[model samples]
Target: AQTVTQSQPEMSVQEAETVTLSCTYDTSENNYYLFWYKQPPSRQMILVIRQEAYKQQNATENRFSVNFQKAAKSFSLKISDSQLGDTAMYFCAFMKHAGNNNDMRFGAGTRLTVKP
Candidate 1:
């Protein structure tokens, strides 16, 4: 079994600034995937970035990047040049890379407010 945790329930960032959302996970499996998903007001879960356990390099998507620490089991999301559209409920998720089980564990979520 795997579990994801988001310590901060809410956060605010100024427009054109940067914000980092923290996430931690616990799992016994050696192979897995870590993800940061952004769900806007419309409630659509959009993938911000993803990281594989075996990959040492962190994943990045434009202004969105991840600080993945495999040893500490930490996968945090960094949003640069925050925009109004970035305001949403961000969720940290985990999934096993192998096996027939396709269950994904999600964090409680962190609601980010990008203020202009």
Candidate 2:
């Protein structure tokens, strides 16, 4: 069975600062994708960043980035220059290499609060 785990239940970051959230997963498949999704008060899930298992380089998008360690099965999200708008429930997700039936699994989530 595949599973994702977010050790932190909540996190806080000052404006313009940086924060890193931890995530780990268990999976047997070698080929897959890892993602970090942020859900705001509106309840919309936004893709923060994604990392491919085959790619050795970590993924980055502006202030959002991911530290993907395939061997350790760890994928952590780093938010730089955090802003108030960044406050949201962040989730780590995993999806195996499937044709159409992509069974994506997510972690419990980490609620991040950005303080001014």
Candidate 3:
């Protein structure tokens, strides 16, 4: 079984600043994918970034980047140059890559507020 944990229940950052949301996971499976998703008040789960367990390089999408520490089972998301639109509920998720099982485990979620 795999589980994701987000220690911070809420976070706030000033516009144009940077914030890092922490996430750690416990998993017996080595082959998997980790993701960071953002859901605004609209409730749409948007993919911020994704990282493969086999890839040593971190995944980045625009101002969103991940610090994937495979040994520590840590996958943190760094939102650089935060904007007002970045205010949303962020969720860390994990899914196995081997099987057809599309099941994904998500964290409790961290509400991020980007202040002007």
Candidate 4:
């Protein structure tokens, strides 16, 4: 069974600061995908960023980047220049490479508060 784990249940950051959330996973497949999703108070799930196992370069979007450790099966997200708009519940998810179902499983979620 493939499973993703987010060790931190909550995190807080000041506006313009940076914060990194820790995550680890257990999987036997070598070629899969990882992703981070953000759900705001509006209860809408938004895709933050994604990482392909075959990609050597980390994926980054604006102020969001990922530290993907394929060997260690760890994928962490870093948010820079945090803003009040960044305050939301973050979830880490995993999917197998061309597996049966792409049903994404989300973590319990880590509530991130960006204090201005």
Measured against the true structure, the TM-scores of the candidates, in listed sequence, are: 0.96, 0.98, 0.97, 0.95
Tell me the tens digit of each residue's lDDT in model 2 across 1-116: 99999999999999999999999999999999999999999999999999999999999999999999999999999999999999999999999988878889999999999999
Candidate 4 residue pairs in clash (backbone atoms < 3 Å): none
Go through the candidates in order and give the clash count of each: 0, 0, 0, 0
List per-prediction Cα lDDT, in the order shown: 0.94, 0.96, 0.95, 0.91
> On residues 13-86, what C-alpha lDDT tens digit does candidate 3 reach at each position?
99999999999999988889999999999999999899989999999999999999999999999999999999
Q: For model 3, what is the alpha-carbon lDDT of residue 20?
A: 98
What is every candidate's alpha-carbon RMSD to the true fold? Answer: 0.9, 0.6, 0.7, 1.1
> Which regions of candidate 2 are displaced past 4 Å?
none
Q: Candidate 1: where is the Cα deviation over 4 Å? A: none
Task: Show the colliding residue pairs in model 3.
Answer: none
lDDT of 4: 0.91
Q: Which stretches of candidate 3 lie over 4 Å from their true place?
A: none
- Model 3's alpha-carbon lDDT is 0.95
TM-score winner, 1 or 4: 1
